[model samples]
Target chain A: MSAENAAGTPPLLDVKNLSVRYPLRSGVVEAVRGVSFVLGRERLGIVGESGSGKSQTGRAILGLTPQPGIVAADRLRFDGIDLLSLPPREMRRLRGRRISMVMQDPKYSLNPVMTVGAQIVEACRVQKLAGGRAAKDRALDMLAAVKIDDPRRVFGLYPHELSGGMGQRAMIAMMLVGEPDLLIADEPTSALDVTIQLEVLKILDELVATRGMGLVFISHDLRLVASFCDRVLVMYGGRIVEEVAAARLGEAGHPYTRGLLGSAPRLSGSVHPLPVLERDPAWLA
Target chain B: MAVPTPPAAQHDRGLPAPPAGLKAWLTSPAPASRTQARLGRFYRGWRGFVRNPAAMAGFVIVLLLLVVAASADLIATHSPTVAGDLRTERLLPPGGEFWLGTDDQARDIWSRIVHGSRVTLVVVLLVSVISMPVGLAVGTVSGYAGGVVDAVLMRITDIFLAFPRLVLALAFVAALGPGIENAIIAIAITAWPPYARLARAEALQLRGADFIAAAKLQGASPLRIVAVHIVPMCMPSVIVRVTLDMAGVILIAAGLGFLGLGAQPPQPEWGAMVASGRRFLIDQWWVAAMPGAAIFIVSLGFNLLGDGLRDVLDPKAAER
Candidate 1:
């Protein structure tokens, strides 16, 4: 814990040489293989098709990899604290207060029985706030901060009462209440409408820029990531094959990234048959 | 000269605004369902049963029974044990002076039925309170923890449930040997396993829900999670089981009494009353009919309540 190391820390959260393997009944499945990344106070997006283990890498960083899944890393640091060494109790304390996560679907992520305000208040109460009113005020402020109209009404409503877009916004409000150093948004806006998706992304962008919180945006769409994130990690077969700046995603050299770009339909471009992804057997190996 | 006005002014302006009225307030959309709203719904559903005609009728009958039981001092002319009062009238039928007739002891049968309700209700409520928590805790731990814990606990529940409840109660009474307290203990031991099994099944389903994960993520203590989330979520099923089991406890307690292990001597339990009256069925049908009817009413009350509550509380049932 040198002063220089703390001052010049590469990023708020730095994960180096991480590997995770799950022991199933049949055999071991390597979910992540030597994945490495640095997350500064900028949006970093990981884009991969399903089963590519992009989610596993994010989970491994937060020590949330499910049971029977072995998570190992040479270095997993969050604001100079060694993440892998923390006990379960301390890790739980860190989860919502310091390094919060916005899970993929609000429908599954939120507690259906809990009111949006209570859920947000519960998150704020994780760190033991002053009192009930303070927690409630903070929860309402967060709902308003996420650009929710009629925050008072929305706060009292249950998850089932909300539309998909409102649910995601409420979830974002809950995650960002503590203003964590790093916010890992796992498909945060996937369930939202196109208009609401832009609104949510804009709110996320504003929060990240204002608070200087590092973000790891996980998604399958490279185009959205390209426009929204600062740096992009193209994951294929649980490995980070190509890393490029957001604007330079068009010039990405890897065949998988090229395939992903080509597969996505363009609005203005004259259409022929869409490009099918060419599989490389070596990629699996 | 008339002047053209803006669209906004045409709708409202140029004159003083109309005062807000009750109609405006009534027409406003409801504010949202908060914790208070959820609690209000629960209370409304709970009170709805109180308003049911059958339950209300049963409640009145049960209440009258309780009043008779409680006023034994003024109601009963003589002690229950003073059998064959040779000087006084015997087997007096319902009349102006006798009022539902005199028993073999010349004690009022109606007064005894009232007092008998107090005893039955006490035993039923006591046994229920004691066993419900025991079943809920053991069942919740087994189901929610799963794996080894579930196997071990469920095996114990299986062993208890393997024996017939009456047989188990008889054995328990034989071990303790006679009296109302012993009967209650016997019934409590025999009755708890069903509740435990039901609660376990409920907890198993609730443990997998997203709220549990959400609670965990919020760093809620395990005890708080169990008390607040797990228990409340499983309560509807557990409560229905409780209502059903309460009737079972009352029947078992009465069975113990009939077997000569409950309410010794002059305590005047309904079961003992029926047992004593069985020999004189042809001569004294009222004695047997009265206490037998008490048992029937109690068990019927619980069964009907359990059925109604199960329907009202179960969301899946509502869907069907």
Candidate 2:
């Protein structure tokens, strides 16, 4: 892939050693431990099972971890801007403008009372990208870009009025209207049907490529990641156990990655029992 | 190569024609005019209201009281404050001159009850208007801005809630001095704590909602998040609470008036009128009974309206 060949290009996001810890009465639980990865201006997928801290890793990048979640990193930078030490006011300016996140469930993520157009316009207005008629125009254009059949009609509809696929598309439209340089999509299509999922993926793939924006696609579906992304980072117990080119994912060296691949139910294979993932304490260490 | 068509009689044999009424009901078009659409909406709401007997009764009583309060000038046969000849009119039975009889002061009891609704309703409105915004702001700020801010605001709210509502209002009124305005201020001060508590609970629930997180990610300020996102979600329950609390506010204002701390005598305040008629309760029942009944009816109306509002506004109710 071109992303692999472009080795000399500087990474858009650089993380040396990042850790997220939550303190409890019992003890401090380390959700993410010494995780490090560099994201270039290409599609990079982070695949992991539930409790693997994949979502936390995405939230940590955007500084969206909830209260009592202590995020620590040796070096966390986005385009050489030190994210760790950036003031909240400056971080606010960078958040939706430079780096935007599309949450897991569009049903819960979009404001229920606000119209599709108003929400998109708010995203643009908050970033100072556009205002009033210009914002409305940009919002409509973004809606059309996301393949919404009737942008004008959909614009006035509330989130609950739209179906699951339409709501997800609206969310994407709202997030992308600001034209952020980097997008972190946390399980954006998990709540959708298979057919709708493919359509959403297509729109995302085209947008990422056309905008030349870096994408950190977080999900558990390995086959999808391999097909859609240029590179994949396999996370296990909050650590990056493997990193491989998406095309070369089948030949991954890590046992965990191999085990994940083996667990998938195949269409052509004989009816052998699926292998359960075996955990090793050393993986955590 | 010619295709054969099904006979028209064969097509008719396949299915029976639907009843005209059923067909009309199923295929009725949307309302043609804006006014028609509005009326349709109102009709649906009214139907839902009428389905609940208690709510309907409450609505009717509240509506009747509102009409009586609004049209006191037209309804009352005589001036509420003007006293008639004491020897001739005092303690007269319900008849020609005085419809509901006269007080010991020879003032028209019916006229006083009708005019007294104005004072009671004003108190209710003032208390609600004053308390709701104050409580909403307090609760939203406290709940949304959790941690030290939440801790401090909630502790203060707890202190206020610890005192019994009526006792607190009485104390405030006693300190602020007697009269309708002071009584309103007292009731407003006491009324807000419950709203704050309700709003705070709602805010806490909504503070962690995904939409709130999304707004934060969109670079919305704390104020904007609370105002635009948190407040609207919290308002439905708060409104229901306000409607319910209107009953209590009316009662409290009347209590203050009875104690001579609100709506001073000769002003036709319901509670003060009731107080004045106490001396002649046995001799002239209508004097106290008339205003007392008015108070009871108006309070009942507010309570029923509040209950109906809860049924209508609650999303959970629709689900059930």
> Highest TM-score: which candidate?
2
Clashing pairs in 2: none
Error of 1 at B319 (Å): 5.6
Residues B1-320, candidate 2: write the lDDT tens digits: 12232342133333333223422323325533333445556666676788989888888888888898899999999999999998888888789888888888888888988898888888998999999999999999999999999999989999989998888988998898988999999999988988899999999998898988888788877888898888888888888999999988988888888888888878999898888888888877787888788888888888988988788777588557
Q: Show the lowest summed lDDT stretch of 10 residues, model 1 chain B.
A: B24-33
If you score just chain A, what TM-score does every candidate get?
Answer: 0.94, 0.96
Candidate 1, A4-55: lDDT as tens digits: 2455656678888899999899999998988988777778999998878888
Please give the CA lDDT of all the candidate structures.
0.79, 0.86
In order of listing, the candidates' clash counts read 2, 0
Q: Give DockQ: model 2.
A: 0.71
CAPRI grade of model 2: medium
Q: Tens digit of lDDT per residue, candidate 1, span B232-279? A: 666777888888676777788888888788887688888888887787
Candidate 1 TM-score, C-alpha based: 0.83
